[model samples]
Target: MSILLSVILPVFLVIGIGFLAAKRNAISPAGIDGIMRFSQGFAIPVLLFQAIANLDLREFDLRLVGTFYTGSFTCFLIGMLAAVYLFKREWEDAVAIGFIALFSNSLLLGLPITERAFGADATQANFAIIAVHSPFCYAVGITAMEIAKAHGHPPHTIPAKVLRAIFSNSLILGITAGLIVNLTGLPIPTVVDEGLSMLVRAALPSALFGLGGVIARYRIEGDLPTILFTLSLSLLLHPTLAWGLGTAMRLPDEAFRSVVVTAAMAPGANAYLFAAMYGRATRVAASCVLLGTALSILTAAAWLALLS
Candidate 1:
């Protein structure tokens, strides 16, 4: 209950404020777009860069990464197979559905929730997971999408396509630069580091508010069954797998909490973007992003309580 009030509610309150503001026409759509662009494009990337650049490379745990990603991949496969075999979705649409399950809101939801539940200093595992998150999810999602569209075409072009898609992202660029600094021990000037620190402080709140406003644009109108199923994969199955695996591997409390909390996040807006990018299942993806986020408020609080 304390966790719900202190940790979860504040985060959602900000989101709710944004939702109301947008719904009431208090903030123009262009204003919401500007907020999202600043947060997603600039502030969040700076946050990631600072976190990754300063991370202790020695603390990078394979078990932690494996636990989180194994869960993600499992959910992806389950979502994809079920979308096709059970829901009678087309292959391309199935792939898009799978991606909605795979791409958790690790940045917008994971970081703040974990930081609030644990503490600011306890997010190294989260950073480690996030460092590779976009690349890994996009790779799997794009590869599957291409294969679905190929109809048995040779996959020789898939790697390049995946690289192009992932690298083109600003978040990926920030991560890449962070890795370079971490590995090479390059020094960031004190003034620039301070500037980035200022930006990092604005990242989560701004992004969360922007996310809520963006979600307000989506209507929960169709594909109810598929949306519910994908939500199950994302909010339930993914974290269950991580929890089981993390326990089996005896992950330390911090790492265990990080992986599970991150896994428990709702599908990100990127899910809808991926669906739109492929021109498949866009409505379903949009609905999932909106409804799944609403559901995750309770689901995430439950996970935090159990972890406690």
Candidate 2:
């Protein structure tokens, strides 16, 4: 209970504040965009970089990463198949649904929640997962979208394109730099470390507020059944799959807890962005983000209690 009050409650309170501000027009969409950009481009990268730079790379567990990612991939495939066959969705739309189901908001929501609930080790685990997550999820999504749109004739330069996409991402750049620092055992200058710490302090609250702002802007305008189905997959099945796979693989308690909390995260804003860009099932994707984030208060609390 103290954990919930100290950590989780504060997070939601900030989110609620953002939601009310947006609803009352106290902040413009531009303000929300700025908040998100600052959080993602600067604050979070610094935070992640600092964490990764300090980690013992040799002791990092690739097995835990493999297990969590594999479970996400499995869920993606299953969601895509279900969307196509059961929901009668077009291939492109189905792909969007699949991406929404698989890509948890591991950075924005997962970082604060896991760090608060499980402390520094869990934060380290969360950073490790975030390092490769976007690239993997985006790679799968790009391929599916290309195939669906191009009728099986995707660009011949896919590998180059994927490589560029992955490297161009700010989050990946942070992870890469951190990996370099860790592998080489380079010392961070005291000045640089102090600067990063200052910037990192802004990440969590800004991210939570930005999350609420995003959700507040999302308008649900889709078939109820499809929206509900994807919501179920995102909020329920994804976490269940992560827990099952993590336990089945006999991951350490901390690692397993990390996986479960990450899996329980709301649908990422990236999913909604991808859907809007593809112009397929945009409503469903946006609804997933909005509803998933709103409802996650309860689900996250339950998971935290169980973990405790």
Candidate 3:
């Protein structure tokens, strides 16, 4: 418990300070753009590439994959529905809420913590699910948003627009490219490998710090209820759901424990960053992020203890 809390506390403190800073008109979103871009474009890809590359594809199980996907998909769908419905908003607004609500920060926060608590196997399980997550966010997640955004506009070509969004997404393209490299089993040149390694090294800390910078600029005054609601879904509801789903699926103990805790432990999905980037309810998303991140330390610690 102490070990888990020790890791989470500092991470969120930076996030909290970031939030307070944001509220105070320090480190505005524009100020953090470079940090955000570098982390998203360069660093996160390195982290994700190494993760997927290290995965033993032979160990990939369709049944296990099905079970994991079932859990993720269900949670995402349900959470989003709840959020949108609760907000008394339009379907597009609901779609945005659903996208963020359904997905946790499985990549940045979940992966590393799972690695620490459970080992590579647990981390990889989440990674496999997350590989699915990355694609889904690009395809299904964004399409929902784009469709919502376009509904009021004059009738236009839907398929072309959808394709454009998918093809143009750097994260989607990066993951697809990385997976292709991993699946092909080609030997990477040392120089290329080193180059990738350097980028990956920068990805983790830079992203963390960038997240800190974003938080530094967050405003949380009127959004407290939304913050609490999202936290309940993330730190509490999501874990409970994962626990129930893991049991029904008959997952192994480590896998079961890891996913249950990880689903709960992960910070708000960086998709919140997307919300702000596009200027969609940025304050709401930012506030949820700041609060969710701040509470994660205690909540995660409490969760670790309960699991033990």
Best by TM-score: 1
Which candidate should be chosen as best, given lDDT against the real structure?
1
TM-score of 2: 0.94
- Per-model TM-score, in order, reads 0.98, 0.94, 0.83
Colliding residue pairs in candidate 2: none
| By TM-score: ranked, best first | 1, 2, 3
Q: Point out the higher-scoring one by TM-score: 1 or 3.
A: 1
Write the residue-wise lDDT of candidate 3 on 146-219 in tens digits.
77778577546666766786667666666676677788986778998898889887775667666777766556
Enumerate residue pairs that collide in model 3: 18-215, 18-216, 19-215, 22-216, 22-217, 22-218, 43-203, 80-98
* Candidate 1 C-alpha lDDT tens digits along 1-308: 88889998898899999999999999999999999999989998888888889999998899999999999999999999999999999999999999999999998889889999899888889999999899999999999999889877778988889899999999999999998999999999999999899999999899999998999999998789989989999999999999999999999999999999999999999999999998999999999999989998999999999999
lDDT of each: 0.93, 0.83, 0.66
